[model samples]
Target chain A: MKFDIGVILASGHEILSGLALTVLIWIAGSALGLGLGFIVATLRRYGGPLVNLGLAIPVEILRGTPFLVQIFLLYFGGPFIGLSLDPIPAGLLGLTVYGAAYYSEIFRAGYQSVPEGHVEAADCLGFGRIQTIRHVLLPEMALIVLPPAVNMTVILLKETALLSLITVPELTLTVQAIGSQKYAFLESLFVLALVYWALVEIAGQLGRLAEGYFSRYRTART
Target chain B: MSWKLFSLLLQASGMTILVSAFAIVAGLIIAIALSALRLSGNRLALGFVAVFVSFFRGVPLLVQLLLLFNLLPALGISLSSLSTALIGLTLCTAAYQTENLRGGFAAVPPGLIESADMLGFTPVQSFLRIKVPIALRLTFPTLISEAILILKASSLVSVVGVIELTKMASNLAASTFMPVELYAAAGLIYLAINQVVTLIGRFAEGRLPGTGVPAR
Candidate 1:
């Protein structure tokens, strides 16, 4: 069997479109996940024991199972409860919720890493709970949280490939389609692997930049 | 759901456990070998391990599975779906386990190595006896976590046509129109399996000497 770059290049238009969808889904999913994860983290922190227990069940279940199973349930099992979603929406929602579970845990760890004295100091200054959270806790946690959160983002990006399994026509599926159509399975898969590697590399570089930016205050203090 | 449906999912979970257990053990052995190669100070071996880690860790496991599924036949290396999935899972997990082991090896105290040298211990003996034990102890918790991760990831094998728990649920759901029940049951089974794994990890951690104590 011959390796042919030409075959992959010939399908560049389809590949580009698929890549666009992958990026779009990754951005939307990351945004939704981060926002929702913050909310869950906050609730877990301040919510009473009952609420914490209630939240832990779903979060643990999500973390414990495979993302593929969760998406299948949402996309296929949803109709039983009168909820139906298109492939893209289902993929986005599944990815978002799955990410939130992990992200929330990251946030919780971040919050815990902050010193207890810091919270007490805020209280001594007559800071309200919300103000302490917003002013004192968040800034400190931001530095600790960014790396893991960005890591989760990269994981979510890789997860976009799984979305192809649900027929969202993402890069993996598009390349596979081209592979079958062009009889260039190896070449097409090679293209797919390279594309995903590039995406991951880009995400990693952006993470480093964000980390450096977040730590600028400490750098300046020194 | 019906008892029969639940039992069917249970039966499928056996394959999930079988594949995941094999992958975790195989991955750890390969990871140890890779870690040894990295420590061997051979540039060629170092570069080979570096590329292997970066590629496997960078690419998604799903894509890797698909690539192997297709690429094998092209190379005239025909394999069963189970074997292909096993190979993919092992390779992917080995990359991660190798990284974790690298950290574990780094954390081994230099004083211990120096003391072993003073005691006339051969480099190989000291590494096998002193370094390997300390590193494995330091990395035990992480290794257990990696095992759970591989177990969850085992679900992806369904794509290669291995009838694991997830696939069984999908098939039964389609035929019985009980997607909700089947999927819920599948999710519960995964949760139960992972919980058992976590418990075993915790139990083993308690028994392992010097686990939580810092190396002197």
Candidate 2:
């Protein structure tokens, strides 16, 4: 009944830094995810159906299940396999791998959405394979892909909390530490929730901004 | 201890499947209701539904599940672990599904609804017969995707010691000192069940024939 402002504010200040760590993990992991997604998307497109099937299988399996178990496997189980990463690395690895699966789909959609005329025009202009992809295909897909990539970034940010379970010292873990100490489990968790809400809202806003700016750039190109 | 451990794992997997079944049913009802309320022409109801969906969908499912299982007990509404886990999964799952339903519902052109309205179809009648069927058809793949996502999320119940497959595997690993093997087996089980579900979905879509999607 007596939840003091001072106690909550002080604990909130301590846990606020967890947001920075969350963003850092998201940025690093998502960059890795994007690279892997591009390769997977390309392979799925031109590498034929069986390769697509192989690509699809991992995405389906990872997409179908909850990330919590995947994080657990990475966090606790990695040590048994001679790759004894700490919690942050394992958590990042798990989310990055999972994100790659979804991002590949987004990429494939974007790649397909690029009008055939654009690519053919590049070919007519004497651009070779790598040149066409680098100068033409990538830019066009960027307009379509940027929005969902931002969405996936927002998603991976929230998934970072699973890292807390294995003691990654992220925002949720920090909040959990305070909660268990004061036994204000609800208040402490409520704090985590609001922090997460703000984090996502900001990321979403930035995503919209990026989309707007990118669209303008594409329009200017024409 | 090994025999006891094996039995505990079986119990946990049973619990996992049971809770998942409860969640899928509960979530579908809540999602359909929320989808209706979204188009209810009531500002407050629409606003409330929008906030509920984004809030649940924004946060990680693990965090939401944790709050439900652990926090409500402190707020003087204690439930058993199974109930807490079920409610947690249902709430989050429904929130996510509402958007899918809304999108599916949205894909039915406004013209179609207007046409039905002009034909003297009452709002309720139009929604039930025209909107629901078409929306469900459009959203079949997305719905399958959501169900798979929910099944994965059921693993979080293991964290609160609800002893699902993940929990069972972890327990067996600790007792047997073979963590990797135990988790691999558990992962395989998950992958297998999911593949079955995917196949069934494909078969169902094949039978429907005119649902506007090709079966994968």
Candidate 3:
């Protein structure tokens, strides 16, 4: 009948380890998603109509369906296709692929917002194609892309909780296990909610700081 | 892969649609009320709405559902798994919809409200006839996207024991040992449902008044 903070504190060790795993997965997933997303967006932009169509289909399917289903398909279905993976690897792969679909869309929008004039201007100069992309396109895209990309990262962070369903031993599963074993469902869940809330809040603040840092670049360039 | 298994998935997709429909409608009503509370000049009401939005939006839906699934029994309020799932989804989507509605309302021109006031419309009349409609028009596309989001999110309900499309696929996969076929089929069904939602949204948007297009 009473709420007990002690219940959560008692499982501090497990909670800490779970938190570690959650952060690790989040960072790795974000890095991979961003990198892979950039590649896909580049291909979509320059790969011509047929290549764009090919890339677009998978991205749309990934965006359209639930992450839970996508992860299930990969984790459970992988074995049938001779691509078996352990739970953590499977979860990481799912998160990366899922996050990439969103990030790629963001990048594609960012690319569109960069004017054709800028590209043509870059072409007039002696800059190589890769140099033009590196020096001109990416800088322009970064300003527009940073906010949504951060938003997606926060969303992906929350998604780490879903990895618990596939038995990834992240924060959610850790708390659930503690709740069931210790008979402190309310307290454990309270802790789970608090931890997730704090994580998302921290991610948002970091996003704002990054935005500020990027805006400084904008002002300096001008 | 079998016809019977596919039928089961289809039936489960029906449940997914039903649950999402209830949540989206219920969420919109709650979101509108919450938006009203925010707009109202009462400090206590505004504070309540603020905290409600932050807590619901800050916490992930899965965690919210699990919290309700566990906390409800502790409060001596026993609910079915379906009820728990519905409550969680409705509350979660309500927070998001409230944010969208606030943005929509903010975009409503000040001139229109002032015109309504000069025309001697009651505050309530002006709100219902003018504000709500404009805000709904502005927020329509976002609302449709939110609807699709809730539909995909409904897949999480299976954790609480509701056999939605995703859950049905997992169940069939385990039984038939055909995870590839079952999950792919489930994914395709979800895509089909969302495409239908998108098409309907586009049709409704074109028909919406004041968009310079005539309704059919």
Candidate 4:
């Protein structure tokens, strides 16, 4: 079978639109995940073992299962529970929940990496708990958390491809649709791979920049 | 809750375990070779390994599956659905496991290696007796985590037409219109599998020598 690159090139506008939706979902999902992760991490840190166990169940379940199944459950099973969501919203919700499970673990590690003396120092300075968390903990955790958070973001970005499975019109779906329509399976999938690679690579470079920014104070002091 | 449907999901979960176990074993062998090559100080081998890791790590597994599924047939290499999925998962996980192993090898204290040298241990003996055990101990938890990840990721095989746990659940749901129960059950099975993996990881960590202490 002859492979044709022109088929994909001809469908640039459709692919670009799909890329836009992919990025939009990525941003929203990542934001929701970070917020939820922070809350869960805080709860795990301060909450008793029972509370921790209670919180861990959802995280464990989410982390253990595939994202594809989770989305299927939400999108297909939503109406039974009186909750209905369109494809994009369902994708966003699924990604957020999935990201939260992983990010909460990341944040928990970050929080634990903060020295005990630092918290005591905050207490000694008469800083309230919230103030200590906001000023002392968050800054320190940011340095430790950035790399993993960036990693999770990249994974999340790649996972947006799975959104295509559920009719999200994301980049992967767009490419697949084009491939089937144009009989350019090789060329279209190859392009899809390159586009995802470029996105992940960009995410990596941005992560390095953020890491450098967060660790600047440490470097300066040393 | 029909026992018949539940039994079918269990049988599908068995397929998930089979595919995942194959990938994990195969990936471990490839990862060890790649990690050894990475640490061997051979420029050509190192460069080749670097590209291999990047390509596998950089692309999404879902896309990788699509590519492997479609690209192979174009080249006149027809693979079974399970074979295609195994290749995808093994290659991807091997890349990650190589990195993890590299980190583990690095974490082994330089002083211990120097002492081994002073004791006149041969390079091969030193590596086998001293370095490998320490690295394995240090990397065991991460290896277990990776194993669990591959198990979950094996669900992507369904896209290529292999009906693993997730696929089975979806199939049963569509036919039975019981998406909620089926997906929920499938999710629980995944959780149970991961829990067992985690438990085994912890047990192995406790049993492994030279983990938090020098092998001597």
**DockQ (Cα-based) per candidate?**
0.85, 0.48, 0.81, 0.77
DockQ of predicted model 2 = 0.48
Each candidate's B-chain TM-score, in sequence, is: 0.94, 0.87, 0.93, 0.90
User: Which portions of model 1 show Cα errors greater than 4 Å?
Assistant: A217-222, B118-121, B211-216
Residue B3: error of model 1 in Å?
0.7
lDDT for A22 (candidate 4): 95
Candidate 3 clash pair list: none
- Candidate 4: segments with Cα more than 4 A from true spot: A47-51, A219-222, B107-133, B211-216
Kindly report which residue pairs in candidate 1 clash with one another.
Answer: none
The sequence of per-residue lDDT tens digits that candidate 4 reaches over residues A141-178 is: 78778989999999999899999988999999998899
**Candidate 1 docking band:** high
Which tens-of-lDDT digit does each residue in A116-197 have in candidate 2? 8888898899999778778877887888899889988898888888788888888888887888888777677777787788
lDDT of 4 by residue, B1-216 (tens): 699999999999999999999999899889888877887889999999998888888888999999999888999999898888989889999998888888788888888889999999987777778877888777888899899989888988888899899989989999999999999999889888888888988887777665565443
lDDT of 2 by residue, B18-118 (tens): 87778987998898889889989799999999899888987777778777766676568878887888888899989988888887787777777899999
Best-to-worst order by DockQ is: 1, 3, 4, 2
Highest DockQ model number: 1
Docking level for model 4: medium
A50, model 1: CA deviation in Å? 1.8
Order of models, best lDDT first? 1, 3, 4, 2
lDDT of 1 at A52: 89
Query: Model 4 misses residue B26 by how many Å?
Result: 0.3
